[model samples]
Target: MLSETPRTRHRRIKENGRTDPADLHAVLAAGQVAHLGVVVDGHPMVVPTVYGHDHERIFLHGSVASRSLAGRGEVCVTVTVFDGLVLARSVFEHGVNYRSAMIYGVPRAVTDPGDLLYGLRLLTEHAAPGQWDYARRPSKKELAATRLLALPLAEASVKISDGFPDDGDGPDAALGLWAGRLPAVAAWGTPEPDPRLAAGIEPPPHIAGRAGAALHPRRPPPG
Candidate 1:
């Protein structure tokens, strides 16, 4: 279950709040990037990074020298997927359609050799499926230079906005104006291989197969 602390509560737009822990998982699974927020020397900082998560925790990593990961205090990670734009007759009613999740927790640095490799595998697979097995694993020196943090998924807040403009039922409807959702969806393009690659080398099936697929795909139903 998702924890509902004051930090995770939806005080204003309560109607859009989601309480199900599964919703948070779905949001995280669909998105590729996350904004990691932390405080450094009494100042706030937010750094965008790639993340991976399982049923209980999220994995975030960066260079060991990165200031964003130097903080030992609380951290907030947010993932947002913009679905579209909700245009209304009135400018005041214009809004966007999106799915977002915010997680709050103190992250613990991953140090154990086995755990570090496991977390790195999750991060790599989450960003590019099948790449871990296809590419060489990280060497010892590379692993030592990296810093991975694991945060519990126990405390999170999720909100989804999928509705059309509410002004349709109000006086704004009288205006002779067009109003609808302009969806912003992302699709993968053809793969561009490295120019220095050996001749005749082609993209693998997994990489080539993603062309034209949605970046944030709908979660398939479980069997």
Candidate 2:
């Protein structure tokens, strides 16, 4: 179960709030990019970055000089997967179907050589499953120029909206109008080889196999 702190308490739309830890993990795994919110120079800044997560924590990295990766005080990381658009007879009843999670905590900078290398591998593998093994690993000079941070997944807020318009049972139902959902799905496209590649070179099976695969697989509802 996910701990419900003051920051995670849902004041409105309580029904949409999810307390299960699995739900949080699912949302994080399905997303590719996360927005990291932090205070820089006393001003709020939100930076988009790729992230990787284990069962207990998430890893984020960027250039060493990046202000957002300073690993300072409190921070908020959010990941969202847009599912679809819900259309209703009335404008007020229109909504969206999506899965989103917000995590708040203090992140620590990864400094140890072994831990930094491990974290970097995780981040790369998360973004591209087999690419990490296929591509050359980062060198000492490259590693020195990168900054990595890890944040605990202890406190988080998860919200999933997948229902149809509630106006279906209300007066809006009687209106002579078509109302439904326009679903959105993301899929991987064919791989394009680099122009500098040799003529005989081609994408590996692991990369080519995902050409038509869904970016985020649909999960079943809880029992």
For all candidates in order, the CA lDDT equals: 0.90, 0.90
In candidate 1, clashing pairs total 0
Candidate 1, 94: how far from true, in Å?
Answer: 0.2
In the range 1-223, model 1's lDDT, one tens digit per residue, is: 6778999989987999999877888899899999999999889899999988888889998999998987498999999999999999999999999999999999999999999998999899888899999999999999999999999999999999998898998998999899999999899999998999999999999899999999997683111
Q: Compose the digit string of candidate 2's lDDT tens values, residues 30-135.
A: 8889999999999999999998888888899899999999998999999999999999999999999999999999999999999998888888877778888998
Pairs that collide, model 1 = none
What RMSD does each model have against the real structure?
1.5, 2.4
What lDDT, from 0 to 1, does candidate 2 have?
0.90
